[model samples]
Target: MTDLDTPAAAPPRAGALRHAAPALLGYAGVRALGLITLALWSAANGKSAHTLLTARWDSLWYTRVAAFGYGWEVRLPNGDVHSNLAFFPLLPWLERLVAALSPLSYADAGLLVGTLASPAAAWGIFAVADHVYGRRAGVCAALVWAVLPVGIVQSMAYSESLFTALAAWSLYAVLAGRWLTAGLLASLAGLTRPVGAAVVAALWVAAITSFVRERSTPPARGAFGWRRALGMLLAPLGAAGYVLWVGHRTGRGPLGYLDVQGQWGNGFDGGYAFARFVGDKFTSFPSALAGVGLTVGVALVIWLYVSCVRQGQPLPLLVYSGIVTALALCASGYFGSKPRLLLPAFPLLLPLALALARLRTSRSAAILGAVAAASAVYGAFWLNGSGPP
Candidate 1:
């Protein structure tokens, strides 16, 4: 069916929120456990969980943007320059707005935005899985996402949840054949992060495929419409608009954004740098276990993509997850941050979620509970240890 195929959405089984409640509640419970564990662990170490969530790592960069605006940079003794320009503006912009409207500090505002966006992201993930498999699979998918080793990032003042929320809803809109809604949300997603391109790519691929289908299939119900064409036009504007603005501001033309990223040691090198980093981990006996772990993680990610393809997921999902995976894994730097980067690639969990859905309720719940506790403990330890970049 074409993008105009509104009837592509299944007949109303239940009101969206009413149906998504299980996923949402399960997600909330998992997140709560994580936060509680973090709180207790941090307290025992004389640290504040709130500080970790709102003031550390990239959260500092985001709050800096909200408080002082951009054009900030950190020049290190090693000749590395970290520029705030490397960060997309939408999250910081929202933080600024939230701070202006409330008594909360910029950091707190950022945490608030992420806290709200986490549930939205979960709901959107539930929507997608439910549409593709069934209600039970959807619940499992959302819970699966919650139990991710880096799932604690979803609750921090980070852009991952915000971007995922926008991306997931945009994808849902695409699957529902609401072309305009899809494009609009995709545009917003693009505004949120560099990975937003994955959503734009998904929309473009789906729209182009629809065009190809229309060329062969006779015009009738669900045929390509002007809305699809307009959606195709709208999908890239957010990213392009921001990049072009940076270009003009930097006087470097269209590639100025790339220069900004480079200033922060970020660029696309097709995983070469990442491979080297992982390989180096094996140079010392003390680090070889981590090296092997990294290799296994990469292999697992790749196998999941293959499973998605073999499972015959819709083109939009396959394209979206593929690009998200490639970008997250292939990035030249931020080797330790790759897992956090994959937060938006929720579709990768569908295969496992579908399998989990087949288990008896008690068995699945027990397994999920154990996994969730482990994830929560690991999240606490992670933040207390090296932590995410």
Candidate 2:
């Protein structure tokens, strides 16, 4: 790699805190706005925001897993069975840990974990962007992620926040050449979400490229060798271990976890199912408009990724974002939740964030503030109505 391509070294803890303060504060403000809006909307609608965030939908399943260790299933009227094993174990494990140490219930403990982790995720995002671009871009990137329509999930009793925190830090570690740290974080991410494989893949690609580069260059005495190999070995263990354990428990052998996910109508079909879903959306006028919007959104995401490649973004970020986008767009379940699933693809926002950073401060603030308000309102309405599934 050229000197320009080398990853920026991380600032010390105190320096990092100082540098990232604005971004963290901005992200926290956006989340606080979303929560306040949700609280007001819930009160007006005779509902509880706490219950909405902590006791509903996937949150309930996570809490159940935390309180009782898996082995739960729900049989739908359509004769489909949904197994709790479809959910990864990290978030629940954290919830259980928090609940054990505190007076909180499993659900509340989950809320607490998500609440704390969201800002940490933002910080990791800022560190990565700052390393790639600069502090202003980093701050913008964090704020952009914060104002996403589905950003409220970051503050709920969900695994997205936790997983994003791990993924972001893992990517940062990879960029900084901290192989072991990257691998450990990637493994934890795998334990958190299936998409964690994106992280593992990025690390693997980076390790391979480093090995090739070292072989071509005049090797220094102490160089990239055992550490990189060890990281590659550690990277897949978390996801593989969980999947194998689930298989063993369910008596389905190696494919047991796939069977569990299949019960939920989720599997990798190389985007065929998603293509059909979009086509079905065009059956009516209103639905056709929705389909058009979906198509445009997907196109925009692809264009942004291409922009990153054209700009020669680091290989790790490119690989990580590409895998994340592919998985989110191609998932076969919960059509309405694809946007939420795309939350971890934060690098996709970096190009836009850089543009925003180049704008005048007043202009950028106005744009971000307007979007944050709209996102907060949308999040409130979404939760009060049919939120992410």
Candidate 3:
């Protein structure tokens, strides 16, 4: 059988359903409660829950992009340029496509995008977990992801879920040796978010590793070596091509997107810019406390990356995690959103999911259900009031 036709192996599944029941039930129940509570919360806050659910925040931005082609820009007091061009094109492109095919408005199209992408993300989470750990781990990973407070984003008209869905599937494809699929998805991911580079890096690492591994092995009869090598080469092309094209259009080099990010108060400054911002946060006692909290958070992120690497996680996971953590922490924009920005890292979801999967079914369900409930409420309240997380 061809590699593509070979059934991908799953972790031990004998007791997986029992182990995963609690998480699944809890996640669904809590999210349902959150949806209701959030709507009520929005109503109480003098914002129409209907409007809150249907409009505002990044949703508005995406809708605008879909309704009108790029060219809008807002010059902030800080001289930052908040431009339509800053948004990667895929989400809006999807919105446009969806809207064209149906009676849905752009906003509804975005909601549809998030709704569909969330499940895809869950599937990717399951596939990756199954590949790396076991079926139990995979089940737990999907539940954790599905129930995360950030899961609220998945229900809204945002791009994170979409980007994550693409990234996760691309990683899965690469791990399964479907290089072209990996590249195609990675390209779509790139069109979705500026941080798509992380996905590209993961694919590249996997390809290079595969290339080296195949080289060291004795030739096997009937092995499609040339086809496999070509597949590896194709994986990173999507992101690279888009970025280069963006550069071409902007009259900048292929790194034009990075320049665009800088114009919007974001860029990689080798951590120096973030340090300066953190230093300012320490000037006031209250802010200093917040700064300390952020310090602990950054430390935890570093720890997670180190732990994943030490625990024999896949190289693609390590590469993606390292890139995302670096990008979030070292980012020069709204550093407060660092946690949310890295939410799509997905690798961090594994250990906790594995732990939950090991729990007694009833107890695990109760615990995870409670957490999911809280997360949903928090997600709703956050979205209704403060915009996107």
Q: How many pairs of residues collide in each model?
A: 0, 0, 2
Residues 1-389, model 2: lDDT tens digits: 22211344656989889999999999989999999999999999999999989987899999999988899999999999999999999999999999999999999999999999999999999988988898999999999999998998998999999999999999888888778888999999999999999999999998888777676666561264676787889999999999999999999998999999999999888788988989999999999998999899889989999999987888999999999999888888888888989999999999999999999999999999999999999998998997658
Q: Which residue segments of model 2 deviate by more than 4 Å? A: 1-9, 221-224
lDDT of 1 by residue, 1-389 (tens): 22435426554656777899899999999999999999999999899999989988999999998889888899989987888887889999999999899999999999999999999999999988988888999999999999999999999999999999999989988888888988999998999999899999999888777777777766774454778878878889999899998899889999999998887778889999999999999999989999999999999999999999999998999999999999999988778999999989999999999999999999999999999999999999998887758
**Model 3: per-residue Cα lDDT at residue 306:** 75
Which pairs clash inside model 1? none
How far does residue 343 in candidate 1 sit from its true spot (Å)?
A: 1.0
TM for candidate 2 is: 0.96
Q: Rate the local accuracy (lDDT) of all candidates.
A: 0.90, 0.90, 0.74
Local lDDT at 374 for model 2: 96
Query: Candidate 3's residue-wise lDDT over 241-313, tens digit each?
Result: 7677768878898778677777877877667877887788899999999789777877776776777877778
**Candidate 1 lDDT (Cα, whole model)?**
0.90
TM-score of each: 0.96, 0.96, 0.88
Q: lDDT of candidate 2? A: 0.90
Instruction: Output candidate 1 Cα RMSD.
Output: 1.8
- Predicted candidate 2, C-alpha RMSD: 1.8
Please state the error at residue 262 of candidate 3 in Å: 1.3
